[model samples]
Target: MRHFSVFGAAAFACALFAGSASATQEPQAADILFERPQLEKLKGGDRLDYSYSFKSADPSLFGPAFDDRIGLRVEPGDGPDKKKVEVEMFSAERRRAAGPFEDMSGNPLLSLMLEENLQRLAAIFQANPRYMKTAIRLALRNAKATPEPSEGFGDAPGWRVEVAPFKDDPHKARMHGLDTLTYRFRVSEAAPGEITEIAISARDAKGDVLFEETTRYAGKH
Candidate 1:
C-alpha cells in the first residue's frame, strides 16, 4: 500500500533490488548521479525495458502524452552483488508493482526515474516531497558527467547528466515555472540495464515544452 511514489515502492522485487532508499539510486554516468555500481553489471533473466514517455504543456494541468514501461526481471542472488529484482510499472499489460524484494548495489533506473519525477512534482507544485527531495539532492550532488560516446548506438559507452534542480530556487516564484526543470541522464554500457537514457524537461519564458518525461532504453526483451 505504498505507491504514493517518490518511491517507497518495493514489490516485483523492490524496484530492481536495493535500488531504492539511499535517496533513490540508479544508472551509470560517472562522476556522480547516485554514486555507482550500475546494477551489478546485470545477470538473471536480464531485462530492463524502458520507454515510459510523458508530456505536458498543460494537458489540463500536466497530463496527456503517455506511455509506460520500466520493467525489470533479474533474480539470482546469495552472492556476487546479491540481486533479486523485479519491477513493472505504469501498466500496459505487465502490471507488477506490489512490494518486497531487495538486496544491494544501485540501479533501478534510479528509483524509477527520480521517484516518478518527484511524484509529478509533488502533485503539480503543492510541493514538499521533502522539499522536492532536498532540491533533487542538490541537483544530483552537483552533477557533471559528459563523456558522450555513441558509435551509432552499438558502440554505446555513453554519459550525459544534466541538472537544473530549480535553478537557484530560493523558492523560485513558488515554482510556477517549475524552476525550469531539467534532469537528463543518459548512461550506457551499450544498454542491458546500464540506462541508455532518462529525461525530464521544462520550458517557458518563451521557449516551449512546459513539461516532458522520457525513459528510452528499450532492449532486453
Candidate 2:
C-alpha cells in the first residue's frame, strides 16, 4: 500500500494546498492554515468552527479555480493553547470526473470540473484540465486529541492521521481512489507532554479495515 506509486495524484493534491504565487510577491509559506474563531477562543468546553479552501497554484488543473469548505470544532481546554479538534464535515460541490485522454504514465485523464464558466480573459479559463473539485463533508465528534512535535512533521511536529469513508458513501466501496486517506499532523501527546506517534484506521460497514497510518513526534513542542 505504501508504494502505490500515487506520486502524480499526491503531488497534484499537494500543490492545491500550497498557495499560488503572485506577480508582485513570492509564494506563500503554507498551503493550508486552520484559524480559530472568536467564539472558540473563549474557555470552558465551547466548540469552535472554521472553513478551509484549496486552490491549485497552476491554472492547468482546471478551467476555473476550486474551493471547498471543511467545518471543524475545537474543545475548550484548561490552558490557553490546549485544544481538542472535531472535524465536522467536508463537501466538494461541482466535482469533476475523468477525461478522454491519458497522461505520460498512460493513465486515464481525470479532473474536477467547475460549475461556473470561466472569464474569457483569465489565465485559468485558458488552461482547462479534466479534473473536477468536489466538496468533502465530515461528521466529527469529541474524539481524543494528541499534541504534535515541536520541530515539524517529517522532522517537525505532527502525527499522521487516517480517515475512513462513511458506510452510506457508495462510490468509496467501488473505487480505490475514493476509499480513504491518511494525513500527518503536527501534534503531541496530551498527557505527560511526551511526543508520540499516532495512527487511525476505521472499518467500513462490512467491517473491513479501511484507513490507517503511523506518525511519530521527534521532540517536545
The candidate that achieves the highest lDDT relative to the unseen native structure: 1
lDDT of 1 by residue, 1-221 (tens): 33534555333123233333444344422333444556677877777787788888788888778777767777776778767776777685535453334664556566667776787778876788778776766566555567778534865667788888888888788788888888887776656656677788989889888988988877775
- After best superposition, candidate 2 residue 119: deviation in angstroms? 38
Worst 10 residues of 1 by lDDT: 9-18
> What TM-scores do the predictions have?
0.30, 0.24
Give one digit per residue, the lDDT tens place, for model 2 in 1-221: 11112223224334433443323332221211111122223343333232223332234532334334323233444445554433322354533222211111111111111112111112333422221122111311111233334443244543322233233455445533323332223332231122232333334457554433233322211
* Model 1 per-residue lDDT at 18: 32
lDDT for each candidate structure: 0.67, 0.28
Candidate 2 stretches with Cα past 4 Å from truth are 1-14, 18-170, 176-200, 206-211, 218-221
Error of 1 at 166 (Å): 9.4
